[model samples]
Target: MRTHLKNDIPKFDIVHSHSLYLFHSLVTGHYCRKHGVPYIVRPHGTLDPFMYKRHRLRKMVMELLFENKNIKEAAALHYTAAEEMTLAEPVTFNAPGFVVPNGLNVSEYDHLPKNGTFRKKYPELNGKKIILFFSRINFKKGLDILIGAFDLVQQQHQDAVLVITGPDNEGFGDKVREWIGERNLTDKVIFTGMLTGEDKLAVLRDADVFALPSYSENFGIAVVEAMACGVPVVISDKINIWREVESNRAGKVSSCDHVQFAKEINALLANEELRSIIGNNAQHMVRDYYQWDKIGMALEREYTNILRTRERRPQSFKVRGDASV
Candidate 1:
């Protein structure tokens, strides 16, 4: 963003910004407008309903004063998911918008160590159907709902164990542990503080199912990661990529309801044949859709299209610097 501060910044075909709705975003947009350079904005779900409500008045005035105009005149606004596009307000303001799903770099999985990294560490998990919920222990992730759903899932599959892995955000992990203790799942649930690298892949490789009941997720990269490892997933429909999961038979997408989530998770655990079929399908879908190589080519195409249909630069353009300053 400091590039905008200099009076003599290098010329570029387009200024692509993947920032939140902050002063830096508006400044980048302002520079684009003032210099007649094409710009594209990626809100990365910051414009979603939940975030917009956080500072309603400030965002509203900022949008009117700077963001809206910048977006309206931009080459295009970029969205990572279809649902994100639909959720955007003033949808028509950005005359044209682009949707590009997030891509995964599979190299991270290329040299992954053997499975059971967790099992070797916690020998008690042996012979248990490990259901994993790997994400930050935050309210937005619906960890409580997942715990409730897992309670129901365990009743049907007595040997099933839930492993909640992730760093505690604002001590939410402690809160989740309290919930587990209250339900007498203290023995059934395992909490591994923040998992990464070989350890992360080991857990993903061994887990029977990967579940995330996020209240709102633009794209669940973890879901894709599970699919990449040939593991089935269970996610809430609130995830923007739910359609892709449902259509590809990658896994199940349930409503936010804990009961519904239990039903979906139970279905996968009850039928080994169904699990294998869905798991295989998920792997295939990720190979076909989520590869970073394929996504990079798609982005090249979008940039080419924009460059080809290049608009005339406005000579009289100047930054007001009123709101941005």
Candidate 2:
């Protein structure tokens, strides 16, 4: 890969490095600098504080050695959300930055499986108001908060079931189960392992609400996916896209606290009309802003701007957490 970059990197007008703290980014940035070719670096959430602290010492070493230089010399730093850019500022250190959100193929959700498809597969969930959490079962996902919130949610909506769908990461699923069992919610919460393709979309279609109270998320793609399916969402402010969800009135945004999270989830479950309103807003927002075609155009424009202004040093600019390009 390094040899290929050495030979071919100059052929391109510009380069866009996707992640940091790796040999690939290091080599790519090296070649771009060497050949005087412009390049952009997208941290892809790795620069968030929560993620950075996980392997503190190793990352610190990498930063001192090469990663810091790779970032400092880049033409521009691309962040998926403005909140992400803010949280990453200390690491990026006044480097030129821009926000461009991750997007989905809207057509993938146009013809989701029939409403009863998911219920048919999981008969026990039939007739129950489903609150779906679809993402990897990892420590950062804040399942503890969700479980505690769901326990409170059950007090008011007894017929509501919490459906967790994701592959367990590092045995975190076992720990999550223990938390549920401690609250005597083992029967109320169902783990579907990991659902993909039609099965995942079917579950999204049938959900009364989708909730993800992640402690830290660079960009919550799952939240957007649920919104695309016209499912009302209750996500924590820690998810960088929370501002977009709130600003668009597409969904509810709450603090990471279980009490607050529970209230948001319960409100959606209780009021079908409110859910419909927000769900419709969510779908429209996805179609208008989160679709791949729209996002692609925004990226193309950014690339064009970078190419046009290649002679000038990228100026430092402040981001106000807006989703618009």
Candidate 3:
């Protein structure tokens, strides 16, 4: 990125980054600085405690050395949600920051085809309530905990089916499949690999509930997508931007506990009235906050500020001088 910027000085304002933890962003930000470019860094919840808990030693050292240098040198920091800004403030001595939750293209689903082929593929889901989980399968995502919780949910609602979909990040997807087989839940749980476009919308639109048991998520695009489709979400508080989920009354948020997970899911599943109320709120919340155009305008304003700040300062280019004293 630095080399590319060096080659093509893309005349632009604020060179805002998505995440400082990512090597490319950090490097690019440094280049912008060298060329007298003013930029803003968005941590995107990468500094949350949940992420810090994973590689404590390495992360701590990086923070003290390179990471701190790169971030503290920026003009400002951009955060996607309140939790991210709160977690970031004490960790670094940097310029001011603001929250801008990630947005989605709502128009894409405007003319989506209505299809329930997923129900036909899995006969168990034919006349049952379908709880959808769509994201990469990983330990950090808490899929195992969800599976355990689903067993308890099944005890009460025999008609509910769990549909887990996403690309297999590691071998976790296969392991989950094995788990379902052992429990003889092969008929209850369905796995659909990486869905997109019409298929994705169809599933979301048909779902009775969207369950994301992730251990840590910066911004759950899937959560917003489900809400756009008027599906209530059941997620864990570990998702950094969970405030959006809660304030919207999109669904229930709890810890990554198996029992609590079951309780939340069961409450929503058994009570159709509560589900409808939550689903309505979810759709309203998306229309209010998750629209792509609104978010893009906000970002444009930030970039304009950066450009204005840069223009006010003197250019840093040096000129040759004669040393004839």
The model with the greatest TM-score is 2
TM-score of 1: 0.89
Q: Flag regions of model 2 displaced more than 4 Å.
A: 311-325
Instruction: Give each model's clash number.
Output: 0, 0, 0
> What's the ranking of the predictions by TM-score, best on top?
2, 1, 3
Q: Which pairs, if any, clash in model 3?
A: none
Model 3 lDDT per residue over 203-243, tens place: 88788888988887877888888887878789998887688
* Candidate 1 lDDT, 1-325, residue by residue in tens: 4554334222555667775557677777777677766777777777677655777787778878887777778788787788878887554464688888888887676565677776888888999999999888887898888889988988899999999888886987878888898888999999888898888888988898889999888788888888888889999988888998999988999999899999999999998999899999998898889899998777666766776677533332232332122
CA lDDT scores, all candidates in order: 0.80, 0.89, 0.76
Per-prediction TM-score, please? 0.89, 0.93, 0.88
Alpha carbon lDDT of residue 2, candidate 3?
52
Alpha-carbon runs more than 4 Å astray in model 1? 1-10, 89-94, 110-112, 311-325
Question: Which is the winner by lDDT between candidate 2 and candidate 3?
Answer: 2
Q: How accurate locally is residue 163 in candidate 1, as Cα lDDT from 0 to 100?
A: 90
Ranking by lDDT: 2, 1, 3
Worst 10 residues of 1 by lDDT: 316-325
